[model samples]
Target chain A: MKEFKYVITDNEGIHARPAGELVKLAKTFASEVKVAKDGKEADCKKIFALMGLGVKKDQEVCFKVTGEDEDAACEALEQFMRENL
Target chain B: MKTYSGKSVYGGIAIGRIHVYKKNESMVRREKIDNPDAEMERYERAKAEAVAQLKGLYDKALKEVGEVNAAIFEIHQMMLEDDDYNESVENIVRTQHVNAEYAVASTGDNFAKIFAEMEDEYMRERAADVKDISERLLAVLGGGSAGAVQSQEPVIIAADDLAPSETVQLDKDKVLAFVTVHGSTNSHTAILAKTMGIPALIGTDVELEEIDGKFGIVDGLEGKFYVEPDEELLAQMREKQQAELAQKEMLQSLKGKENVTLDGRKVMLYANIGNVKDLPKVMQNDAGGIGLFRSEFLYLESDHFPTEEEQFQVYKTVAETMAGKRAIIRTLDIGADKKCDYFGLEAEENPALGYRGIRICLTRTDVFKTQLRALFRASAFGKLAIMYPMIISVDEIRRIQEIVAEVKAELTENGTPFGEPEQGIMIETPAAVMVSGELAKEVDFFSIGTNDLTQYTLAIDRQNPRLDEFYDPHHPAVLRMIAMVVENAHRENTWVGICGELGADTELTEEFLKMGVDELSVSPNYILPVRKRIRETNLEA
Candidate 1:
């Protein structure tokens, strides 16, 4: 499993578009992915699950990736977080 | 005759036969099925058909309301495809040995309970969406229509609150007006009716079953629905109907005229469109230009603040389509009757006079600049002008100018292409009328919003039915205000226009011409009629 952490900087943090983009990205990989905030975890592959997490700004979010292509998933998510969220 | 009252969502006189749309009959029964597998197969078939119906609605809504409002259908489609929802239906059928209808209804009830229990208020309200989708599924399964409504002739449709999909499925030719017992002015049905210029009344508890196939009149301007009127009332309505028909016939013949007076006084007749989707109707009406492009539609239509590029694309399309004719895009005029959940605006007791229009823009320069930047960038496309709504002072105009300057500097620094366009204000307040001269000195023109101006000047909330008796647009105070505003604009060498329902008042066409009013911006339906009025008018006569 590959684990990573990032703090959301955008005031409207982890909003619809980025969350939708993250879900679409996670689904492209064979690996399992999950995003969590304040110990509440949501399967990152599901758009509704990620949105329901309601990760607001200045809050820390953790991502866990497993199975094949986990490295690729982690790299893509990190880049997305920097560029979007 | 039975009369019911509701909020007047759109203004007109609709006299027609009834076309009651029974959207849901709610006849779910708890009978046992002989085989669980058969019941499940029945549900699977219903689900497939529901998906197909939903897809059609999604595409239509996308065209009608743009991408954001249409996202509800996407979420609905996903809900239909969710494993949990399907599993709940299958399990209930398998375990209880019940009919698919019972199982489906139970699933909706059970899931709604869960969503209603959520801590987030918005999440709680999403129970409505879950119920909306479930109702669609059950509606399809029960052999209920997925909107195959047919009326051989024109009629007024009375219904319960119509779903967005159901509203989209209505035949434009068949529907004359809409009357519902439960809905708000901001509901999809109300907005669509207003956009189509169909009369509508909402929030009335009229029993459609009792009056089905009866003659009725939806008096939208008066906020009342009348069923099976007496001869005298019927005669009055017939006269009104003939007048409307005559007006339409007269307007149709002047479609290509230059909206000029018989005495050779020329004025521009423009359309006030809410969004990019309205552009086709604007063009179809041959409006000389777009006078009031309500930019708040962008913010109102989105789940979040619309990106600058998103706004720019809409502005560019409208400007390019108008092709050098003025497209006066109004900055965000949210608040009052219009609310945006994303804007986080504080609720006010008197929103019409509260933190709206220039107040919100001046305070939240961030929101203001994003719109300005997009508008400025789109100015390169065609004759684009910017207008602000509810400006009541010269100081406010100065502050707004500073922000516009900042946005211009930023755009220039970024090497963006934009033309210097005319800037204007909406003369909608008494104070705006009082300061018209100082305000005109700061802008290129004025466009009066008579609805709010009348309400504000008279201190009568026209939306409140109790005040309907006192709501008079013809009151001398309003006429004087218009005359004063026009006089002030001319003195400043600036053009002034009226983008209000009063602008389409044919009786006042010569009055406005006499006042030297340069333009009249109205809804698309009024464009041709107002143009014809201009053609017949003799200002000097």
Candidate 2:
């Protein structure tokens, strides 16, 4: 299992556009990915689930990936966070 | 003429026959299905059909309204394929043995409830999206087309409410106006209507069935709908409609034209916006720049004081969006009539005259510095100018400059990059006008805020309706003060502008130009009309 954390810097947080983009990115990976904010966890593949987390600006969210491609997924997600979020 | 009143969403006149839009609202019935596999297959097929339809709409909207407005369709497509949403529908189909339409409808309600209960206003609005997609799925499953206008000619559409999908499907050239019995100002219908520049009214009491095919006049500017007008009223409205269309055509022609007088006296015409969302209107109206970007909305919209980073993000966005065009952002103008409980302000008998504008900022140096830090950081992106409001003297300008210098030094020490934004002051108070020459030497420019200037000079409480007769914005004292500010600002090579209501008054446009005023900033809608007035003015005459 590989995991990383990122604080949302986007003013609107994970809104419709970013949440849709995140789901698209997650689907491209073979690894089973999940995002957790506070104690609630949501499957990263689900756009509605990701948006339901309501991770606002300055809020920290954790992404956990588990599979043969876990390392690659973790690295890619972290980069996505830093670049886009 | 019989009349109905409603809240106006957009201002214009529409004289046309009414088209009563009735949505084919087929009720989804929950039915036991013996073949669960067959039912799930139906759901899958319907979902695909929904997606294809959404894709087509996305393509059409992209070509017509550009990407940003069309993005909702793209998002809707993604939402239709959302795992949680699909799972809920499929689960209902398998567990309860319900039909596909019933499953989809139930799931949509459940998900919409979640979004409706969200804390964020933007997220709450997503409830409508969930409902919209589900309706599309239901429509497809029922083997029916989504509710759309069948009218071949231009007509005012009257409906209970319009979904975004239904709204986008309508032929734009055929839509003269929209009147709804139910809808808020922020609804998708209202937004699309505004974007299409179609006059709209919501929360109207008119019965659609009764008014169907009736010749009606929608006076959006007056928020009134006149049904079955008399001959005299019809003739009057006909003349008014012609004038409206002519004025619209004239404004359209003024696009990309210079705000120059017949005698070649050039002036900068800009718009006053309260939020970043107003940028599109500013660009559409062809305003040279944003003269007054009210920064108080950030503070007002928040439960607590907005952090430096939050403030920085907004300022940066405005700067970047404006590109090289000057965006003069007025620093926190809270307190007084506009009170935020988060600011911990005490109620005063005379709140208008109490601690406000520069008063609050100067005393709360911590808040002031935080804002200045954000402003300077954002300035690196594009042309940004900072303006202080309700200044009364040179001492205030000097103190503000000292604080600004401290903020700059702090940024430098922290290895933060920033640009040197032009600093200006609002010459509003009588004291500010009296000492304009001395104060102008301290700032880059002077924006005469005529509203407050008139109230102060005349000693009339503008908020009081009793003083409405005495509250004359066109009072000579206010005009002279503006003229004096212009003269004083020019002496120190400082440009001056008017950012108040008087700025949009076409009667004063020529007089302001004659005063050698460098800029006039009005609301975005008035930009073209003011530009037209400026073009006609013969300054030499």
Candidate 3:
């Protein structure tokens, strides 16, 4: 299992575009990815679930990846958040 | 020639053949079947075809109305694939040992009820969308096309009534006007025609088929439709149509200019729209953003009510399309001038003043909460503001705040997306004006609805043409109210806007500027001329 935490930078929060991009990138690897904010967790693979988390600007959200491609998933998702989110 | 009258919802002249529109009624009949597996296959095929149909509408709507309106079809597509929606259909077919039609009928009923039971006026309307999709699938299963109005050419759409989805799917070029056998002046189709600047008449008793395929002259201003009018009447209608077209062309030219005064003062000029489909026209007119999104149309559009998710999509789409421009959504202001059958409101002698706007919403907390939730969810997308209509006292505003807080807490607990949007109120009541200083402290801004303010203050029925003389929009008392509201709003460090018909009056442009009005939200046609007048006037003078 791999875990990492990142704070939301954009003022609009984890909006549809960023959440959709993150989901698309997470789906590339054979891993179970979950995003958690303020003790509530959301599956990273589902766009609506990720959006439902409502991770706003300046709030820190954690990502947990489990399975064979956990390492790859963690690295790509981090990059995705940094570049897109 | 024959002439029939109803209500004049939109004022214009339309000359065309009658195109009687018949919508696809869901023929979902229960039948016992031995092959549950085979029924599932049938359901799957119908669902696939439904998705394809939606895809086509999405693409076409995208091209014409832009993405905000098109996103609704996407939401419909999502609803089809929803776990609850699909699972219910599957389980019903698998367990009941019934045909696909029976299972779909029951499942649609179950699904639609979830929305219909919801409290929000805007959200409950989603039940119709569910029913719409279900009916389309049923149409596919029954070997017929969904919403394929076989219009030979451009003609007036005559129907009992039109659903919101049906109105959205209409080919604007092919439909000249909307003439309905039964519909309220505040019906969804009537509101559409008004926003589209198309001629429309509702509640006409004339049987359209009697004069079907024959020419008709629709006098929207007078609320009359003349079937097969003589050459003299036709000539008059033609001349009026040409002049209207010329005026439309003239307005189209002002789509790019900034609303700047000659003296270098700039004010945000915006338009009040009835629904999301009206956004394209608002964009074309180059209005900053929607000043008023009258969400009552959502409630009026559906046979039942809408759901929160459905309302969220609409509000979200409008906010996103505005792209950081202000989208002030007024909560459901039904009951007064608007007649909604579902509300079961007792008819009153003075319906306009009896019960409406914030009064109904406040009493119906569930409906109010749903609207607040959808609005808050949409606030995550772009600049969104909420305005309460017909607020007279500080207590109503306070009660609204409590409800807003409750909705916010609920959203926060669910980890739902929301943003703190600017809140405002429509100062339409004379009592609000009398106590402007006290009321201004409760809101972020104030929007003066001068029409209602004038009506209520003067005690004149706006609907009666006989009271036109007494319907003084420019009376000193009304002007005093505007100035007082503006002063009070400014003192509280909030802005004031005029969204009433008076806001568009060129004669009052300088007067409003002098009154310290922050924004002028008016009809789309008046934006340019108002801007031109503002440019010519010097506030100092």
Which structure among the candidates has the greatest TM-score? 2
When only chain A is evaluated, what TM-score does every model earn?
0.97, 0.97, 0.96
- Supply the DockQ value of model 3: 0.04
TM-score: model 2, chain A = 0.97
TM-scores of all predicted structures = 0.58, 0.71, 0.55
TM-score of 1: 0.58
Indicate whether candidate 1 or candidate 3 has the larger lDDT. Answer: 1
What ranking emerges by TM-score with the best candidate at the front?
Answer: 2, 1, 3
| lDDT: worst 10-residue window of model 1 chain B | B62-71
Cα-based lDDT for every prediction: 0.82, 0.88, 0.79
lDDT tens per residue, model 1, A1-85? 9989998866566754456567778888999998988989988876556766777768899999998999999988887775456
> In candidate 2, what are the lDDT values of residues A18-41, reduced to their tens digit?
688788899899999999999999
Query: Residue by residue across B328-352, what tens digits does model 1's lDDT show?
Result: 9999989866988988888889887
Compared with the true structure, what per-residue lDDT tens digits does model 3 show for residues B236-287?
8899888977876666566577776666677878888897767756765678
Which scores higher on DockQ, 2 or 3?
2
Q: Kindly list the per-residue Cα lDDT of model 2 for residues B1-541, writing each as its tens digit.
A: 6899999988889988999887644588889999999999988998999999999998876554445566779889989998889989989999999899999999999998988998998888888888889999998999988876678889999998888788888887888898999888877677767766788999999977789999999999999999998899889888988998998988989988999999999999999999877866776677899999999999998998888778887887788667688999999998757878878889888877899999999999999999999999889878999999989888888899899999999989976778999999988899999999999888999998988888899999887899998877889989998999899889999999999999999999999999999999999999999999999999889
- The reply for model 1, stretches above 4 Å from the true place, is A1-85, B23-25, B34-39, B63-69, B117-125, B150-154, B248-541
Looking at model 3, residue B51 earns an lDDT score of 88
